[model samples]
Target: MGLNGSIPPDIGNLSFLVSLDLSWNRLHGGLPKDICIHNKLPRVKELQLSFNDLEGEIPLGLGECQQLEILDLLYNNFGGHVPREIGNITRLTKLDLHWNNLSGTIPKEIGHLSNLEFMDLGSNKLRIHPKRSREQSYTKTQGNLIQSQRENCVLFVFTF
Candidate 1:
């Protein structure tokens, strides 16, 4: 489908919808601010909007999608710090935000996601917080580490 224009805010009205994949499309625009608010999409487990032109900071309300397991927004134009609220999605297993314009310290809260099994946050301006560097480090058994060229910035992929 040759989708063009923004995602309809009314999509949140689908109370029983589970997953939504509008990836690989021309959808260009930030996600509706309230679309992911608690109970708006109580059952959504996957939300893939990759390969689009969507821009802006990742919604702070996205954490309300408590049931989300896979959130893929790779290859977009999204910028700003990766929201700390994302760590609230305890059920999330795969989060691919690769190749975006995101910058600032990678939230330390991310280390608390015990259920995260795969995450690719590379190719962005993100850096590990100096004080949290030790706290963010995982053993070899937890995941494979990929050191970035940026000094003091280490990005890893937790794949099991």
Candidate 2:
């Protein structure tokens, strides 16, 4: 089907949805604001929406998917800040947001994702300009934490 305009508000109704494949469509506009309201995909393992016309900031509610392991939003028109809440998904292993129009700093909270194995935040306008020395220190600390986490893992692929 040729899904156009904004993503359907009722998409959250698929509570049992384990994997959602909405890639390569003409979907546009910001992701539904209520995309995760009253809906929780606890068993969802993968969410692929790559190569689409999707635009706007990723919904913060996506962080609610506690079981999400793979999140692919590559090759889209999405822009705006990458939500700090994404760091809440501790189970995330593969997160691909590359090839988008997203901007703003990568969230420091991302360091909290202890289980992230493969991350691709490249090809986006992610500017990390720490205004203060303390901020820079904190960001560096987070970077070290990520490095430590990767060191402990046998396999990890990260691209910024």
lDDT of each: 0.79, 0.72
Clashing residue pairs in candidate 1 (N, C-alpha, C atoms within 3 angstroms):
none
TM-score of candidate 1 versus the correct structure, residues matched by position: 0.84
Q: TM per model?
A: 0.84, 0.78
lDDT of 1 by residue, 1-160 (tens): 6789998889888889899999888988898888788689889999999999999889988888999999999999999989999989999888889888999877778776667777788778876565645445343323334433333434463322
Q: What is the lDDT of candidate 2?
A: 0.72
Off by over 4 Å in 2: 1-6, 129-149, 152-160
How far is 79's C-alpha from truth in model 2 (Å)? 1.0
Q: Pick the candidate with the highest TM-score.
A: 1
